[model samples]
Target: MINQNVTKRPVRIGLQLQPQHMDYATIRRVASKAEELGADILFNWDHFYPLYGEKDGLHFECWTMLAAWAESTSRVEIGALVTCNSYRNPELLADMARTVDHISDGRLILGIGSGWFERDYAEYGYEFGTAGGRLDDLATALPRIESRWGKLNPPPTRKIPVLIGGGGEKKTLRLVAKHADIWHSFADADVLEHKLGVLHGHCETVGRDPAEIEVSVEIGGSTDPKDGDRFRELGASLFTVGVGGPDPDLGPLREWLAWRDATNE
Candidate 1:
């Protein structure tokens, strides 16, 4: 369980506008609505094509869209749900994140993951290696990302928060313990409890304080304010709900916002 004293701060809400089959116009509108509704953060998935249904559906690049989102919204924080490591070089990715961080005036959260999806690798001309190999790549790239951030002509104006998303026990959680400001995972109450236990153990192994790492979960419609309260009890302070395209719905978002406000009050 999360240390209650450590998590006295109110829970935050994040919305992921999974860009699967939506056009640019719809994406813009949904982002605007999320900001208008007081979502703490707005996110887009990093994929070249739709991950579901028809694979070759409408899609857009992650960083480019994030740049646009930075310009479009004034108050909401924006970033990719998890930018694939294989899509760009580590230094370049760091630079891109710094640029967007400035564009949003310090509202960018850099969420990264070990590259997955065989289709993304094959279509984009990247080698699809074993899962362990990909995790190894991510491990190597993280420090380079930090190094390039320092070497950049203009360092990121704000300390961009690093969020690592994945639930692998051996490597992914270890990476989170080492480098992540926030760790996102998809699991139910029992599963989440187990993962948190493992993550705590990893933190101990690395000589890092577990409380320094924020825990997040990606939830669906079945999760609501009550469910969120239960998750909070379990140590999840950042709760994200995923909305898929085309014509994504914001009804649940509004409710979650209300829940956030109510809980915080």
Candidate 2:
């Protein structure tokens, strides 16, 4: 588990450069622009195809783009919004993460979750198991992931923060308590508050400190700054604003970054 207290972290905004309906050139430009505008973390999603807009629209792979971002951008930490764990072997994922970490000079956050998209599973020939079974797979994978990180020839540049994304109380939150350095979830203020209570209870059972795990919210950049204030009061430190591709508008990202700076101050 991460040793730092959550209260010690300043509010930071993230931008998910969603890789759909656009060419790589456009996506690449947005990444650099987000950092220039002061986004603290930059993210992309792991999917074989588009999640929305169109079924067969333009899309790019997650980790490959991340590798490029590692080389291209200088300041913002880069990662997938949450990689599907079922896509690759846990050991291989650890290795890929390490390579990216070294490439980015240790600015990679391994945001991951159990497989979710049916299309990604069907198209990729992965078994779309029951939710319980998939959560179990993630449970089994986390230790192997950590162990593999330890045994790599050239270790991760840093501890390589694990950001687990999901809000399942029994399994996902338990996994987060046991494994994650950051927890990403989608919830309004009340739901988030309730989830944090559940997460803290899980931490207690596992002998982990609740504050060691950072809270992250998924949102659009245009979301209200008032809502952001509510989230901060609930202990959320990271906000990820998702922008879709094919001439994506970055206005919300700029607005949120200003909010981030103001909140941090």
Candidate 3:
């Protein structure tokens, strides 16, 4: 049985501050509101172009914005949903994560993934290899990331939580079992149950305990108290609701905050 006690503390909240059409000022305001309203983490997508609206519309780089977020917000933890391995070398990524970790006083989460989004690869001159190949690259990168962290002149202020986001049954889940402190997926209860079973199998294969990893999901426009309850029942304690731009809406965020508090009570 899944341990309900794992999340007896107040449920944590995360917001993905996706930079689409909104200007930097608006993004800053929403991030400030998220922190003021007691969110546990603040995140942004690692994309170069607008993923939703106009294909070539307003967009910003990920790490620079994270650096800004680290300095801008005093309380909320900050990270990308998953930084693409293809964009930056693993050692450099580790250094960047460590820098942000210090900037936030040990409140940074490093969510990483094998690269997706072919446009990002093609436009940026990264080779869009087969999915399996990218996963292979990710497998190779993980150790280098850890090794670089250890070798850094000043190591991370704290052991920054490493979050791996994906649901691939074979290599991805195995990677999660081996290296992730948090596993983020988009599965519904039944699907999540099945994946969790696969993840458990992967953990056994890796000699790691599946229970040690936190399960998380991306709560989109349809989030509700019942949805949260359903996810909680399936072992997902960290629910992230994303607000994209043009103008980032905080209405759903407010709703989620209320639901989180009420559910804990």
Candidate 4:
């Protein structure tokens, strides 16, 4: 149901190098490999603990890892797959992002979302408010983040791209229209089609061009390669797949990379 005529952005691939049950050395190796293999973006999630596998598993902090990635990688852009908006003060997060952007020489993408992991809040001593409240917090936090960016000692090396993830029709999509340069969702083709319409409606209300925002889709679960053509036809320009483990499996990444490169041609 995607209308390719709406936008014709180039296809790009992303690898969410999950920071769970893996050491920093392992992650660095994977991040290096992902870039070598032509990943356009590399991501790590923001969380205190593992979301899967072992209960009390190995994990690393998000912004710290991203700072390291800035120094380590030379080409690919890096970020948290989606940072929890509720965890840090908005201005502080903006400063952290500015620092990382400088380290990477402007190769940072700020991917964030209204947080949903309750256990993180409980263990980290954060308040796990209702979903609506969290989204409200995000709605308020984003402007503060931007305002802080403007007042920083030296501005961000570039206009750091903000990639917002989620698909809640009312608040989430509205925020996307108001703020995000990139809109990510774990949605299938049909659902993406529907949400894109909702997002466009929000854009109309806000007077922003619907085609200005890049559509990003998570691959591997509901999304298959055959769906890539369908997705591209619908204007999804970025595809991301998550990989994890001490010895990470990258078969899907290679396949997805191939699709991305082929589509770009």
Give each model a TM-score. Answer: 0.97, 0.97, 0.96, 0.97
Write model 2 residue lDDT over 147-213, tens digit each, in one string.
Answer: 9999998999899999999999999999999999999998877888889989999999999989888
When summed lDDT is taken over every stretch of 10 residues in candidate 3, the lowest stretch is 1-10
Error of 1 at 162 (Å): 0.4
lDDT of 1 by residue, 1-265 (tens): 6666436757889999998788889999999989988999999989888888787888888999999999999998898899999889999999999999999899999999997889988888999999999999999999999889989989998778999999999999999999999999888878888899999999999999888888888876544678877678777888888888888988888888888888888
lDDT of each: 0.89, 0.90, 0.87, 0.90
Question: Where is model 4 poorest over a 10-residue stretch in terms of lDDT?
Answer: 220-229
Residue 24, candidate 4: Cα error in Å is 1.4
Q: Which model, 1 or 3, shows the larger TM-score? A: 1
What's the lDDT of the predicted structure labeled candidate 4? 0.90
lDDT at position 208, candidate 2: 90
lDDT of 1 at 46: 92
lDDT of 3 by residue, 38-153 (tens): 88889998888888778998888999999999899898999999899888999999999999999889889999999789999989899999999999999999999999999998
Full ranking by lDDT: 2, 4, 1, 3
lDDT tens digits, residues 1-265, model 4?
5655454788888999889888888999999998999989999999998998996899899999999999999999998889999999999999999999999999999999999999999999999989999999999999999999999999998899999999999999999999999999898888888998899999999999878899998984323566787777788988888888778877788888888777767
Number of the top lDDT candidate = 2
